[model samples]
Target: MGEDYNPEKEDVYLMYYDVNNLYGWAMAQYLPYGGFEWADAKDYLTLPEDSEYGYILEVDLEYPESLHDSHKDLPLCPSTPAHRARNSAKTPDHAEDQT
Candidate 1:
């Protein structure tokens, strides 16, 4: 049987965009996950305050289990409670009806 794919085991990344240049770029890392603290992305704390420069995107790079297991020491970004609660409140069912 073929091997299973695990998204959580994949590498995570933070992509930065250049609005004026109309392009984007990503950092290079050997591990599947970016070697950064979770707090940097949680709570929108690390997000750029300015809109002109563009924004950051969190991406999960799906890779083979062998590769994922090789770099298990890499740090994984954390989804904070506050971020989860905020997203949960935005669900269509939870959204307020506009009449």
Candidate 2:
């Protein structure tokens, strides 16, 4: 098939790349109500607390991909729920339960 390019796969990789770029400046926010948001680059860099949103988590591109594997046993992408849960669990509120 002459290197069948999958649009789905391409979209995923593009998304991962964008999120990583956002981390380069702004930060990823983990909301308490099971939602996520991103803070402005300036706000994130300055560590502002008046964002009127969730907590900001510093982004580390070197870290493992937030969504690595799939639930279907194949080396595919993860669902929205799975990714959200994984990221949410990384929050301080969730980690505090460990102690």
C-alpha RMSD values across all candidates: 18.7, 14.2
lDDT of 2 at 52: 61
User: How does candidate 1 fare on TM-score?
Assistant: 0.22
Look at candidate 1 and tell me the lDDT of residue 62. 61
TM-scores of the candidates are 0.22, 0.18
Q: Residue by residue across 2-99, what tens digits does model 1's lDDT show? A: 36756667565665644563233223212233444343444555545443333346687666667655555553543457878876665565555641
Per-candidate clashes, comma-separated: 1, 0
- Given candidate 1, what's the lDDT at residue 98? 41
* Alpha carbon deviation, residue 86, candidate 1 (Å): 9.7
Model 2 clash count equals 0
The residue-level lDDT of candidate 1 at 92 comes to: 60
